[model samples]
Target chain A: MAFLEVASITKQFGNQLVLDQLDFSLEKKQILAVLGRSGCGKTTLLKILAGLVSPDRGSVRVEGQPIQERPLPERGVLYLYQEALLFPHLTVEENLGYGLKVRKQPKPQIALQTERMLYDLELSAHARQLPSQLSGGQRQRVALGRALLVQPRLLLLDEPFGALDPETRSNMQLFFKKIAQQYQITAIFVTHDLKEAVNMGQQWALMEKGQLTHYQQLKDFSKDPKTGLQQEIAFWKKIDHQL
Target chain B: MKSSNLLSIGLVGGFLLAILFLAVGSLATEWRFPALLPERYTFEHWEAWFQKKAWMYYLVLSLLLSAAVSITAVCLGLMTASGLSRDKRSFLWLRLSYLPYGLSPVLYAYSMQFFYHISGLAGTWLGVYLAQLILVYPFAVVLFFTYFDSSMHHLEDQAGSLGASRAVVFQSITLPILRRPVQTILIQLFLVSWFDYGITSVIGSGQLKTLTLIVYQYIGESNLIYSSLASCILMAPPMILWLLQPSRSTKQDIPV
Candidate 1:
């Protein structure tokens, strides 16, 4: 059975249908990148998976067990926002230790794990600094580290690097890809950037006007003229030819 | 003059005048009209006021009342504001929360007099506390409603999805992020309750004697020295709280 299965999800806001019978599934430790424009229900889909929002009609199963009406804590899903929403009052170390502490892990174990995460995220030097003291890239790293430390069964990213500068965004993308592989994490990354989706995801999906179109491979995604990758490639190719 | 410059000057002028009055009124042993300066200066009035057991009782009572009111209001406000912020359907009733704050406290007290009489809370300390709570909790709600932005809701949802229970989410995420704003609201509510006169007077019915009432009585009796001493006592805690406020540098880094 697939690690995660989402079937026939439908949602509406008043008279506006925001999600229309969307269906997808993922294998264990696989990453799916969802590409879409604004108001295309990509975020809504992620929220539904994270248990932050409910679908009007759908069944989400993890490990073949239905997750419908399950509480967030029981669902074991986490969502990362576009902006790094670190706890401003806590130091980086405290932020990293929050999940373990909440889980009632032993003090020494929590400290050890937090220390390892800090080193892994290259945030050891910023252990005592508040979120405001960290740079944008550093803050995002801390947020990612905090989420990863929780060891959720499924992680959902909503343009997690959308606010970073180009250099920082690229660096974070590479870092995410590396850590996700190292930890064998299952995630669904949502982005408006086509390159970002192609770079991070093994499979790709496009959402438009509350409908989703899934592609099994990069070639399949690029070949579909309706997905807009073909037009983007043609435009770049024309520019190269002129040069 | 630029408005900012005018505002600065006005604030400084007001502060200086307050200090001058407090100093003169608390120290002057004799100062007849037409004299720019006091004929004599002494700290006897302040010393005597501080020594009185009645003054201490009133001060402690005032502190306890303010603390109780602030704590209750903030707790209620946090719950109400969080619910209202998460659900747009509750917004229609949000304006109703402001009704208590918008109306005069004395008028509100009059309207609740029948309930107070029947409940036997009309002239007790509990009655005064409840009255002040009714007056200040609405402000607390408004403050928290405005203070908590949409990002906070996102953070809350994220925490919940991270396997944190509702209590854990509140303790680890909501409370930590809202520490500064909550502190600010508590202090504001404390000050409002500490300085309240109308509702306290009407509800207490001469039974509960808080510092404000004592000060008012002193002023009414034309006793400037005792009134000034009471005013100094009233201002001490808030002044200390203001001095202990987090620096601008520390405040700059709060996550949006």
Candidate 2:
């Protein structure tokens, strides 16, 4: 059984059917990148998996149980929006401790965990500062720290690097890839940049108009002699060049 | 920059003139504020205000209504803004609540009287509070919603994901973030409650005598000096706080 599975998930936003019987699954300690053109249901699918939205039909299961049945901030599901969504009123330590505070964890424990997160994510020096004080890259790093401090079982990132400049974004992506491996945390990331999806994800799922049309290993996509995959790779290579 | 400053000066100057005219009329009896220092000034009228116990009652009345209106208006504004921030179903209703706020308060009072009369709420303390809530909650909602819908919306969602329960999210994130706007609305509401006579006279039914109510009543008695002093006292707190507020949204890096 997979660690997470979104099976036949269907969703509609008013008149538009966003996700149509989409199915995908992932293993533990794997990074799954969801790639799609704009207006596809990549975000919708990520939100559904994160339990931020409910699917119209079908279910998202984690470790063989449906995630929908679980309560918020439970089942260790976290969604990192395209924007960092840092709490404007909280400092770095306070933001990291937000989840711990909500869960009623002990103060010493929260302090310990926040310290670990700050040092681990290279955010210790910026801990006293607010989100607005930090540079774009620094803020995103704090956002990651906040998310990681929650000790979430599954991390759902909705273009977490969406706002940074190309140089910053490229560096952060490599930094994040390293962190994701070191922590051995399962993650689903959505992005328009195919190079990011290709290089970062162990598994890549292509979404087209809400449907998960393709799911394959990155090795398979890169190594397949198929002309279709080759063209897709080439197209993203051009984009990567421009970026 | 200079033009805006001049406009502000002019606006203050115009108000000073009107007040000066009123004061001049009052000082023909006793009140005074001359170009520099008054050659002659008497507070026999001011002493008379303290000597009158009715003034004390009017102070209490004004204080009660201001407290009632400001607290309830702000609370309702916060809750409604929070509800509107998340729930889109009542967007039209939320938008419509603000419509009357743009209309003249006199017109609103003119329209509100019939309902108060029918409901037997006329001339009641409850009636004044309700009227102020109706008048001010919309302003509060507008200000609060605008703040919420901005980048603050993202913080709200992130707070939810961060293990804050819906209630926790409200108290921990929403309320704290809203301090600046809520404070702004609070001062504005205090002024509105202190000076509002349209609904006060219409709904007050000659019984719910607030400071403004008594001021106008003093004017009706041809005691303009007495009323001027009374109005000045009534306006003090809001006047003080308005000057005290941080002039702009205190800007620094958003501490998240």
**Among these predicted structures, which one has the highest TM-score?**
1
Q: Cα lDDT for residue B102, model 1?
A: 63
Report the lDDT of model 1 for residue A196: 96
CAPRI quality of model 1: medium
- Write candidate 2's Cα lDDT for B1-256 as tens digits: 6999999999999977866755654454543445453445575777776888988887888888887898888888888887787775667867787798677887888788999989999999898789877888787787666666646666776777778777888899877776776677787788888889888888887888888877787788977676677667766676688787757653223433
Candidate 2 CAPRI level: medium
| Chain A superposition TM-score per model | 0.97, 0.90
lDDT of 1 by residue, B20-115 (tens): 787788899877688887889998887787677788888889999999999999999998888887776666657888777666888888888889
DockQ top scorer: 1
Given candidate 1, what's the lDDT at residue A52?
A: 80
Model 2, A92-135: lDDT tens digits are 88888888889899999999999998888888898887777777
Worst 10 residues of 2 chain A by lDDT: A220-229
The ten-residue window of minimal lDDT in model 1 chain B covers B247-256
- What TM-score would each prediction reach against the true structure? 0.91, 0.89
lDDT of 2 at B102: 76
**Reproduced native contacts, each prediction:** 0.72, 0.67
DockQ of 2: 0.56
- A1-243, model 1: which lDDT tens digit per residue? 889999999999899999999988998898999999988999999988888888999889999988867888778788889888887778899888877787889999989999999999988998999888888889888888888888888889999999999999999999998899888899999999998999999889989988888888999999988678889999999999999
